[model samples]
Target: MKKVIIVGAVGGGATAASQLRYYDKEMEITVYDRDTTMSYAACGTPYVIGGVIEEESSIIMATPEQFQDKRNIDVLLEHEIIEIRRSQKQVLVRNLATGKEFTDSYDALILSPGGSAIMPEIDGMDGHVFSLRSYADMQAIQSFIAREKPSHCVVSGAGFIGLEMAENLSHLGLEVAIVHKSASILSILDEDLSKILQKELLSHGIDVYTDAVIDKINGNTLHLSNGKKLESDLVIMSIGLKPNTSLAEQAGLSIGVTGGIQTNDFMQTDDPFIYAIGDATENDDFITGDPKRVPLAVPAHRQAFIAARHITGNPIAKKGLLGTSILKVFDLDAAMTGLTETQIKEKGLLAKTVVHIGNSNAGYYPDHSKLTLKVHYNPETRQLLGAQCIGGKGVDKRIDVLATAIYGGLTIDDLQALELCYAPPFSSPKDPVNMIGYKAIE
Candidate 1:
């Protein structure tokens, strides 16, 4: 029987192991993870910290016992793969609990090491600083919150994770303040839309500081580059994430400019026997065709499918990522897919943008909240380059439709012809998507 060894047992790795089993029932599959917990929903960590998710165990999707009994796969938690010997098709595994090392040989190997949260270098950051990248990190933050009962929190960075953490922390009745280095929060959206979100954050009693950086953390007080001092009982850093590619680099795999393992369309590394997936691997962008790292769960899951299929004698080329993402800020939903208008201008692409302000449904409908839709397209080719939507409702649906359109290679004009569901309670006769397409023509 063919033996397979997978490193990491989270989103991509666990999914790949199950997929591999589905394709080849008789294959020997063993997954190793350094963490005691495996296959937990990392995205919901913030909710748990905020007490929204009452129990941390609720986020865990699968356990080792479950994988072994149901899937007939060996899942060794707290076993870390220290080194990969490509010549012998073996890996040096260390029992983290016992400090013993062993060698395991594999016919095929998959790496899904994921990423690490970036902790910026700031003076006096040794006290009450936290980052949410792992289950342990979430538990630590919750423990601190429960024990200390911190009254105020200073969240550094204003991206998706940052905003989510802020909202959750605020939900716990803690005074929340967000300080972002960029000109606007949620850089995925343009400044105008981001400004609206900034207002939302402010309206919810969350202080918003733009173009500011944390220079030092002295005790529970944070000093900013803008000459402002914030009294934070604890600080959460959601600045960014760096791909965990040290193992791949040590194995002599080709690393891309994005600092992720470079893989072919088959998700195979430079060594055909070794496959890489998840945030640790960089793939081509959907529109630009340039290498990009998408550290989102959906992309990781999709890559897991592609990698497993290729290993099981079925090959499928990976369609590039659109970087589609969405996040909820207090009461508003912000979503975007494909390239942004700023990115198009930076690429010197000839693009035109259409902005439409309309209602989630018909204006006559009760509680019809306002929605803003912005789309970017090539004037000559009419190809939809990107889209952004922010509203109280229907933002997710429209973004999914646009993302699907971009995936299907649909042009801006095609959106006008889209037969979207229309009702007074759901959408208007000319949906916001259709209205944007119609406005693009004018």
Candidate 2:
């Protein structure tokens, strides 16, 4: 029997384990994770903090027994891979609970050790400040909030997690101030599109400072480079994520320009016997075919499936990602798929973009919400490249459609004439997606 050892049994590793079992039941599969058993919806950690989710146990999707009994996969929880001996096809692991160490052999290896929150070298960062990266991270934050009961909070960084912490902290009735190094929130979005988000933040009474850098974070005070200091009760760092890649690197795996493990479409690393997937792998943008770091859940899960199939010799052809992502700020929903105009320009792609404001449903329909759709397409070929939507309702669906269109290599003409289900309460004769496609052609 072929022994396949998978490191880090979260989304990518866990999915890979199940997929491998489905393909070949007789294969020996062992999954290792430093954390607890198979957990799901780790991305929903923010919602859990905001009281949107009731319990931490709710996020867990599978237990070790379930994987063992159902899939015949051994899930070794709290077993961390400390060293990777690629030449020997073995890994040195340590049991966190007992402080015992051992080496495990594998015919095939899968690395999905995931990423961690960027903890900068600030002096007081370790003293106080939490990042909502893992289940334990969120638990610490939750305990801190409950124990400290801080009246005012400061969130550093305005990316997804930063903004999410900002909104959730504010919802907890705390005064929240966001200090961002970038010029605006959602720095990936175009300047104009970001302005819309800035206005929303202000409307929620959240103080947002752009072009601000934190020199040091002292007790309840953040020292800024702009000759200003802000006081808060607590500090939350949502700066960014650094891919967990030391294991692959020490094992002599090829690391990509993006500082992630280099992998092909099949998620196979330089060593065919070993594979890398999820946030740790260097992914390409389907539209531009350039190395991109898309650390979303869908991509992670998709990469796992791809890697599993390749290991089982049943590979599926995947064109890569369109960077599809969605976030909710209070009542507002923001989603984007494919490439943004900013990304298009960055990639030096000859692209044209159009923005239109439409109602989520019929104009006369009650509770109609405004939807702003931005579509980007190749000017020469009129091929859809990417899109972004911001609104209260139906934003997620529109982004989903755009994501599928980009995956299918659909053109603007195809998008414009596409048939979609519509109802008076749900959509219009011309869906926002088709309308954006029609406008992009103009």
Candidate 3:
């Protein structure tokens, strides 16, 4: 006879709602989302824009009716929960469709407001700027591309989203330019490996501009802080995202240093009955044990399951995150996990980094590309702190292995002992992961 209320309906919120049904069949659960739609995969958005996904509906995983009939969870799309009253164990929900407000009481509440894309404040950027955060945002980009048929495009930022968008936009035969303020693109990849990635971007006919920032936008032209002018048909801003903690903050919840909701190991906020998950909550970093905001769908979903278990009297501690991520640009793929060398140095910790260059398969194999693997380890402990891999194939596989090692608290030497599969078309006898350990010893 317990009722659970969830805010937001994507990623963590939706996952928790569905899992709660399997855990406690009789638990009353209701989900409210500001977006007038059910849960959809946001990660496939760039592919949606690139025409790789012909239908936007293809990305939508579940509809409200599906959840209602099968899971028995009430889904109220466009019903935004504007306020949370901890004392009353209820939230003020606004029917965005009808402009009516009502209170929904709950025995337990979970907040997963997710993240908002950063929009740069600049002159003359009123309509020319677009960001990909929601399904609507992705649809807007596709519509613009289809209607305008823009020949030249300027992308601001060179992170994962920016790089992926750049590749997708370029694949549509549009001339693409990326303007990043940082010294290198893909900052998560260490400087050395990132340089190689920048080379790949350039080889794909995508112009790369480093040490450049947008001062303002005049029509379709961008005035750069580094004294360069870029004219484009449209602009995409993939700068980054911050935790969407506005609602949680207004509810008198404590915000963490990472600009996310502060929660304990049980994902419980100051109020025990209320929990925070997804990008809106800070994660304990595996390497440093610091509160880190990892706006990733995997960690968000995992946290939601753990939080739901705790609410059902099956409390389990939420472990730290490694910040594992991956992206594909043209024929090349990149994936990384844990801390980077720059991050380690920023924390005043000495990291021993080893870059292993090996083939995805044996050198005699027909389809082979040189895979660049960069691993960061503690100088004294030799524990794996982080890793970055860039190649045409096997990049994702190796990063996941290293990510697991980091999660398992494995050291550089531990990678050498891993019995990875080896074959002509797959991996070399001395796999790059094993080579990483062999190099670290030297």
Cα lDDT tens digits for candidate 2, 1-442: 8999999888999999999999998999999999965656787788888887888788988889999888899999999999988879899999999999999999999999899989777866654577778888888889988998898888889998988888988888989988898887887666777787878888998998899877887887889878789988788887888999999998889999988999987888899999998988898878777888888888888888888888888888667677788887777888888877777777788887778799999989897899998888887898888888888899999889888887777887687788987887888999988887677665
Give the poorly placed runs of model 2, Cα more than 4 Å off.
none
Mind giving the per-residue lDDT tens digits that candidate 1 earns over 120-170? Answer: 988898748999999999989988998999999999999988999999999
Q: Estimated TM-score per prediction?
A: 0.99, 0.97, 0.98
Error of 3 at 202 (Å): 0.8
Off by over 4 Å in 3: none
Instruction: Return the lDDT, model 2, position 19.
Output: 90
lDDT of 1: 0.94
Model 1, position 43, has a per-residue lDDT of: 91
Off by over 4 Å in 1: none
Instruction: State the lDDT at 117 in candidate 3.
Output: 93
Q: What would the per-residue lDDT of candidate 3 be over residues 1-442, giving only the tens digit for each residue?
A: 9999999999899999998998999999999999976689999999889878888898898989999999999999999999998899999999998999999999999998999999978888876689888999998898888888899999999998899899989989999999998999988888888888899899989998999988989888889998999999889998989788989889999999889999999899988888999988987988889879888999999999999999888888988898999999888888999898788888988778888888998989898998999988887988888899999999999999999888887889888889999989999888999999887775
Residue 386, candidate 3: Cα error in Å is 0.9
Between prediction 1 and prediction 3, which has the larger TM-score? 1
Say which prediction, candidate 2 or candidate 3, comes out ahead on TM-score: 3
- Using TM-score, give the best candidate's number: 1
The full ranking of all candidates by lDDT, starting with the best, is: 1, 3, 2
